[model samples]
Target chain A: MKKLINKPEDFVRESLAGMAVAHRDLIKVNYEPTFVYRADAPLQGKVAIISGGGSGHEPMHSGFVGQGMLDAACPGEVFTSPTPDQMLAAAQQVDGGAGILYIIKNYSGDLMNFEMAVELAHLEGIRAVNILVDDDVAVKDSLYTQGRRGVGTTVLAEKICGAAADQGYDLHQLADLCRRVNQNGRSMGMALSSCTVPAKGTPTFALANDEIELGIGIHGEPGRNRISLKSGDEITELLAQTIINDTEYRRTVREWSEVKEKWVDLELLNKPLQKGDRLLAFVNSMGGTPIAELYLVYRKLAEICELEGLQIVRNLIGPYITSLDMQGCSITLLKLDDEMLRLWDAPVKTPSLRWGV
Target chain B: MKKLINKPEDFVRESLAGMAVAHRDLIKVNYEPTFVYRADAPLQGKVAIISGGGSGHEPMHSGFVGQGMLDAACPGEVFTSPTPDQMLAAAQQVDGGAGILYIIKNYSGDLMNFEMAVELAHLEGIRAVNILVDDDVAVKDSLYTQGRRGVGTTVLAEKICGAAADQGYDLHQLADLCRRVNQNGRSMGMALSSCTVPAKGTPTFALANDEIELGIGIHGEPGRNRISLKSGDEITELLAQTIINDTEYRRTVREWSEVKEKWVDLELLNKPLQKGDRLLAFVNSMGGTPIAELYLVYRKLAEICELEGLQIVRNLIGPYITSLDMQGCSITLLKLDDEMLRLWDAPVKTPSLRWGV
Candidate 1:
């Protein structure tokens, strides 16, 4: 594979090293049990926020760590979940006197590992809880997820929850806020081409010149369908329509109960979007797609939203979340409430997603 | 070629439409003679900064239009220079009582077209000046440029000079600062693969699976050499070394003279870089390269700069300027004076390259 990397094994470590140096003013890196934390972490009474997943989806958990976003981010190997030790260490490093909240994407490996980390943190006398995000509307279950895959909404959750944490939301309040965001947000992705992992040395999947995989997962997992390549506008309509017309999805999630002092399965459901709802539209590049193309996707998406009577109050476009070098894009629509909109506009000074500072 | 686009002819216009809708809060688009301008244009007496070029190097001229940056931007067809009418229209719309400063990259088509636009503006009694940027150390001449090709340093020049204009620099003073920035900056790029222009429907240039072109131009023009694939670290060393060790370069550039009422050629020379110089290091992706890989480039680049005794006080790492979907990267180092550094830290809220606001 033609990639700018030294060795497949050292890819994650070296990339993190580079990020640490480039953004030293905002974050610091911890090796061995790798995790990235804020430079001035452990604020006396603020609730600490943390998140993690595979390494390939950059600027996600790791790049979001800074002044008003994540207190710490645990980065696993490319497309692999971080081990419990790494997550636990990150929690220990960033936890203040108040509490800690772990923003977990709904992947099997991620759910299992972060659950273990929560238990480990409790054993060390730390109050830690997780808010699971399952906003992907493509498939009910996929290769690495038991339910809907957490996709673009994970980025929205990080920003909103981070701002809420800085706004003095306690651990429980922040967890509820995160869950509300996931319930209101939905996403669907497609891949024009597959990405090659540094270690794999080849594409994770393949497609003919005139074909694409619709509703593809971040890790190149099979989507709902593989079809012939279509125009940018057509593809955007398909993705946005799916998200807009999605039915109420019910799922069982595991959340920590402070009173019970243990995990409990809680049933939750998403509220179907309706006309006149305001949205925070997000158009994301899988990786290899250019920013100009993302604008094309955004252009079509805005039109679809206007037709559906969905008011787009805010929008974000670019490679905020991505799958290595895949050439594709994803559409995410988050129905925003007043509090969510306020927090979304709050100052955030992360390596990625910097504004209002 | 696989790309996310509509008809190739509508690519630039549609992309600009998307940008206008997405960043309506910050910028507005003018059709026919297409140009993007600040939402609050003609900002009283502030000298308006204007830039334009061929499309596809996104977030360059267009995305950089907003508060504390370009007051207006004119976008042309992909890899094709914008017409003088478009530039003149842009200047007319955003020209305050003070004057207009056109930031021109060193390309034959761009220079020629913008010079014509300046003459047209003079006929209309608009005070306009031009600042030329030719910071690439790659070669003395290329397909599109008579002398050195302007590359990554163009982004730095926009940010520094844009901030200066906001800080009350007159048109002539801002033009001088831009020239100083161009003289002290140098860049070099390499490509692992070629990008397909929408209009062309094929790769602009080609490279074998295991080969790369070093010092490649932003338009896929021929570079210094074609060689077998090398490790990312080795590639970084080659590019950074060339930029650091570049000798003094002397060239004559064209500028508009208010007194002469016409364009005049002026000889200019760049000073050789010295040890202990403080730099604002910029590592930019052509397009398709992932953020993780860019960090790898930045990692090696930082090491080399330290070894060369250069101090990096600030850095920008991402796809600020880009080819359509070229899989490669470029590195730029700009020696910073106290004024330039302070202005660099000033607030900018563009669609891309936003910070401190």
Candidate 2:
């Protein structure tokens, strides 16, 4: 394992400075030993959207803070959440009269730090809303932990919610939309190789060349199971089936009639989808999966949907969100209604995710 | 080298199927032996933008198609150009009443196939224009070969030109803009480790743990020289200085009066740049260089720009474009005028590059 760096400790700070200089018009750095927002941000009105996480996922929280998506992003050390103080400063800088929305992923450290920032913001009388994205289906739904971890779905949520916010949807509406995307979407990933964190300077995990870990987390966490490499068609079927089974898309349709019969007053229960409800699918490369391979997965997924008579309204296939450089991909499905489709089609201009102007 | 695939022959076809399934709305496979575009394309009257290249560079041609960027993308096998037939089919399918613009990255196979597609489209009476992107500074300019194989600058050409097309620029104007971006921008790359193309299943080049290859191409092509790995700061300086020296930015400014006198008929030549001109900078990952590392490179670039008194108006940092999984990054700088800045600020909505909506 080889790298180009002066010292491990100087990586994040030096990198941020470089970004500020390179994208002077789009971004600026505060340079006080904290990851702060640039003074110039897009759109002075509406609520400000702020997100931050580890540093390895470039263009994620930081690269995404431009015209359409996040107003400010505080990148922490590689794979480590930013300190609450850093978040507080970002919130202070970007927060206008319209308040702020904190788009947080559900990692333990991320949640805790963002929560502390929210509390601190509240103390300052600056209104804030927190939307925790827990879209990964790899983790089991449990009482002990906070459901599943957030992975690729964060990108979609940020773009969608960013569009809504840019369109003058109040902070509450933006937060609700963010939560809705997180709730409606689910992602499951596998890893053929573990990524080497720059500081560590070696592979994070070792595996035989032929084996792949399924249901892998972004931080190189162990997946649910290890399986031998398979055909693209076979892998697509496995991942798609897992996502469909884990999601409420299929099960909820069947339960719709039963719930309607049990309760007439439940308005939501009566709107049962009678097959052919449209969906938005995303096949994301974890980190190291080639775009070609991701597209291949998308092709097979489309075949499955066609066979099953599901109407895929829209589809996104690429490395929208990623682990460091995990050599695998994840499948994400967002069962869309007409409203979600309209929102999805709305124009967004961010450093990362953008679609439909 | 580890990868997830059953066999090499089935890679491209299987991947195409997966893309169609995952993004059924945005894309659909023709399902004939050849990959074709979805029937519902180019909504109507919107100028079609098409691009294609080798497959390994995921998101290059395919991931970029959507509303604002490419209308259709034809990806070939790993690191191989798509056949002429495929490009012709893609051109026909994506073309609207507004004619088509083919954005060709300056690789031998890419250039040839795209040229053939242009001829085929012309034979069909569909208007077509070609904008060749040749921005890499590593390769010397020559009339015998397409001067300097287009590298990281293709992303800027696609994006800036995409924004122009999205704004309803005529095909000729779009072609000119793409050409201008390619002319104004210059990039040079360095790699730490050679990437393993999925089809090859082996490292493209062998390098010891401490070695680095400079002036590398996106497809794991051999670089100019191999040397001991240096500090990130030193690497950044080496690459940036190389690009700066290769570009005609300062020399053009110095020879502005002479060039203007000689080429008075040319509008662009008549309007030579002054000292206060702004620039757009990009530090792109080869494939595997993390965002953190890329940003570190950007810092050194900023120092150089400051010393040279260059006003960087906008900076894009990250792996917007990439090699398969090459562990390296490249830096790009685009000198900007007011018009270029406005165009850069224009809104774009593509699957890959999106900003200023």
Candidate 3:
């Protein structure tokens, strides 16, 4: 692997150290139970928003930890889940009097570990709660639980929910806001090349010179199928059409019930994107893809949205969520209401994503 | 090359088209003689700042064309320099009644094309001037290039001078500011892997698994030497030491003499970086390198600066300047005076480099 790492074991720790030094004003890194917390976290009576998952998908969990976004982010080893201790430490570190909200992506390892973290935080009297994000339309069913994997919507949800939390939303209200954002968002991704995990020392998958993977997961997971190479416009239409045509999708996601004081299974249905829907279009690069190519994807996506009568009210185009050095792009269409629109446009100051400071 | 492009020939134009579509609120693209200019450009009596070069440097000259940075940017084909017409058209489009300042990097093709454009703009009776940025300390002598190649300092100069223009610096004043920035800055780069031009189906150079290219230039140029791969700290010191230790670099650069109406040679010398020097440290990724790895480089860089008694007062870390998908990074150190520091802190809002809204 032609990577700039000294050793696989030291990669994550050293990366976190490096991040701490580079953005010390914006964040402070806790090494032992690795978690990145805002430089001025534990705001007196504010709700703390926390998110955690595997590494590799950079500028996601960790880079987002700052003033207007995540209060703390727990990072695991590359493509591996963060241990519960890490999350517990994060919850303790950023717990303001109001409470904490865990934004957990729907991955087997992530869900289970965060579940334990929730329990541990409860034992510590931290009043921590969580909402599951499962917005990927690539997977057809939740039976395999390699269930609909969360992708680009996690980023959108982080920004919107973090903004809501900043604007005086309590733990319950912020959790509800996060759940709404997740339910209203859908994402589809594709890969032109697979990324190599530092530990594995090779690419996760191989593609022929003329092949491309459609509906790829962030961690180099195999997509629905490999198909012949296509134009940028064609690829955009394929992913956008799948997302646009997807009917209401129902899944059972567990959420912390504030009144019941226990985890409860809530059947959630993602409403179909109907005509005249105001949407926020996000075109994300899979690490290796450049911004110029992402604009191409947005060009075609804007055209498709116009044809399908979906009004794109706002847009973000860049490599916000990435799969380490993977060459591809993902498209996320979140049907936005006035409240969500305001939150999305709210000022955010983070290492990777920033605006309206 | 496994890129998300429809056809190799259509790469530059299509990418510009995509940029226009995505950033329509901020900028507009001029086709035929391709250039990207600010949507609200020629800001009534503001001295316009125009910069351009080869494509593949993702956000360098193109993504930086926005409100407070660049008035217009001309993108050439992949690694080739843009023609004189592109610059002339851009100058005309953005000439508000004040004048124009062209920020040209020190490359043969870019210098020549911009020189021609300067002459053409002068003929058109628009006061045009330029500042050549040649801060790359890698090249040993001008026997081939007057000594060093222009690298990271071009971006720094653009940003500082862009801010100066915004504050009503005339064409000559902005040009002088850009030249001072270029003079104060020094840079060195290394590559873990070579970048492939979209038109060229292979990497510009090859390296073994345990090898690296040191003192490399941005355009896939062969570096001063190749050596066995080392830890991130070792690599960082190797580059930082070069820029920090470089003293009294003398080179002859040609500048357009308005009174003489001809390109004239001027001997330029880069003064040394001394102890107690307050500076702006920029660690830029060459496209494919991720932010996590860059933090590792910065970690070592911060230590060396502390040890050397150099105070880094401001910093920028990311892939602002790039070479397609090259896996490597470059470090730039610009000794900052009070004026330069104030200009650097001035607000800039662009697709790539932005802060201080």
Candidate 4:
């Protein structure tokens, strides 16, 4: 309600305008289609990587567009999926001779839109592939999603897949690599407080002072259940244990097949994490959590990982992915192979995440 | 207060511990007389730069410790100045043979503790100097402060002067560079809400739903006055014009004189900002605000600068300096010369600020 935006309707458009001006050196905005692409677009022969979703999770799709990362990003209204036109335009704008890859998180709206965009791109003679990401361990079974929701691992996938694409991975290889990342990644989130949408001007949900929602989703949805507020270490332990002890989860999800040229409902399974598994532990804020607090969460997460015989080879702690103005955190564990590690370390020059560039 | 801390008393220490583990390769934390130093400390023959203050404004002193930034950072309790022992030990640990320079913000407790630490370091045969930063145009006249409070300018001073020290500037030269940065910068902040200190367990201040504090300090202190919530552009105009139209502000501030071997109260004056001034504009979040909102602030800031005939040659938009869980923003304008611009662009590899490294 106390947001610094002009109007609820103009929020997304204004944010895009501001982003275009702020990071003009790194990215360019196509306002008609509402997508952000690399400043130096159409890389001639490099595979184009595009991802997008609701606008509230900033620095995700838009901020990640630049050298060695996402080539383009389509943004929708807060908590709303982008139209197929926006995604299709973004793909066409950034695609080179190497083809295009769409990294779609397993949200019903995003999946349908990206799938439609892929079909439209096919008609345009652009080879487009989508690797569905369903890494969230929270939503056991709900109409909100087919199985688990895609949460924090989408960030890791974009970074790794972006690097691989930058290194000349073909479209099929890039899609396979993205699928591998999703299979190895798992995420769980909790909300200390709910966020108010600009239009609503009130919190999506409410809780008592001493209570919190443990398994909350990013869009201000109710979690598994409300619980008493606990200490940092206790909360960290709960999240880590849930993710670490998760059994092999099998679900029927949709993936785009280039040969079949249609969306196919395929059964996918997440392999249970094993002892001595190496990982990149990511602690993301749901917008309102501080870095200091995230580090505290990381401290407990590291302890739990060590006790479970898991090796945290790399770590990212910050508000990388978030729900608008929500006070909470999510823990993501991306099981890493040597190639994934190398790709992660590769140069990335996005607005939010940057290193070795 | 709803916070993600283990225990109120252990907040700073635990965050420091987490920072140590999170950025082990970039920084090292020393306990007892707590302070964070470069992992590879004592870069011999280099003038060591040290900055310390309350802990909530993270990534300012601690997160800025690496190859091209602060050599050491001392952290106090949340919103409380660090102890003399911490600063003293930090000065001793990172004092290369060239000397040690303390970047002290103009808060009474911080200035006093840092002054005592400088004297202590001097007794131990370390060449030490202190530069006071008081660029906040808010708090025009308060019994607590002489002229103004030091707010966002501290980040710019540490970064620009840190690069100068890395390039082998002597103690006196580095101190002078820091002083120049402080004199040329002006900042103003506004708070949409107040923050709760961990130990306090309550917000330091309060505001109505339709009200905003125009010039709130980082530690949750009142500013110029409270006003009805305004649009982003209107608020930006007020802050930008206040800083831009500020006339010569003269006050007696203390500085450590290596030659005199004493703290001296010297008259300092900030010249009125005028047309044709090239500035490095910084838009900082008050912790809870997201990158998207910060960009909105930056957008208005840029338009105002252009309208005022000032040029923003470089800009930084993020929550570099912060007040914990407070939703608001601050804008800093540091007039840049060629040398200052060169130093500003220098590579810094700290946990937060990193570019061209």
Tell me how each candidate scores on DockQ against the true complex.
0.87, 0.43, 0.64, 0.73
* Distance from true location, Cα of A288 in model 3, Å: 1.4
lDDT order of candidates, best first? 1, 3, 4, 2
Q: What is the lDDT of residue B77 in candidate 4?
A: 86
Clash pairs of candidate 4? none
In model 2, state the lDDT of residue B294.
69
Cα displacement (angstroms), candidate 4, residue B300, comes to: 1.1
Index of the highest-DockQ prediction: 1
- Ranking 1 against 2 by DockQ, winner: 1
| Candidate 2 residue-pair clash tally | 19
How many angstroms is residue B82 displaced in model 2 relative to the true structure, after the best TM-score fit?
3.6
Chain A TM-scores, per candidate, are 0.98, 0.87, 0.99, 0.98
The parts of candidate 4 lying over 4 Å away from their true place are A141-145, B141-144
Q: Model 4 over residues B258-351: C-alpha lDDT tens digits? A: 7887878888788989899999999988998888887777888888899889999898888888999999899999999999999998988998
Order of the predicted models by TM-score, top scorer first:
1, 4, 3, 2
**Higher-DockQ candidate of 2 and 3:** 3
Candidate 1, superposed: residue stretches over 4 Å from native: A141-145, B141-145
Q: What is the lDDT of residue A269 in candidate 4?
A: 78
Mind giving the per-residue lDDT tens digits that candidate 1 earns over A1-357? Answer: 999999999999999999999999899999989999999998879999999999999878789999789999999999999999998999889989788899998889999999999999999988999989998899854334599988999999999999999989999899899999999999999999998998999999999999999999999998999999999999999999999989888888999998799899899989899999999999999989999999998999999999989999999999988999999999999999999999999999999989999
lDDT of 3 by residue, B1-357 (tens): 677777778888887877787778889999989999999988989999999999988888999998778999999998888999999999999999798889988888999899899989999988788779888888867676646777898898888998999999987778778888989999999999898887887889999988999998889899989999988888999999988988787888878776676778888787899999998999998888877788778888989999999998888888888888888999999999999999888888887777778
Q: Show how many residue pairs clash in every candidate, following the order shown.
A: 0, 19, 3, 0
Alpha-carbon local distance difference test for all models: 0.92, 0.71, 0.88, 0.88
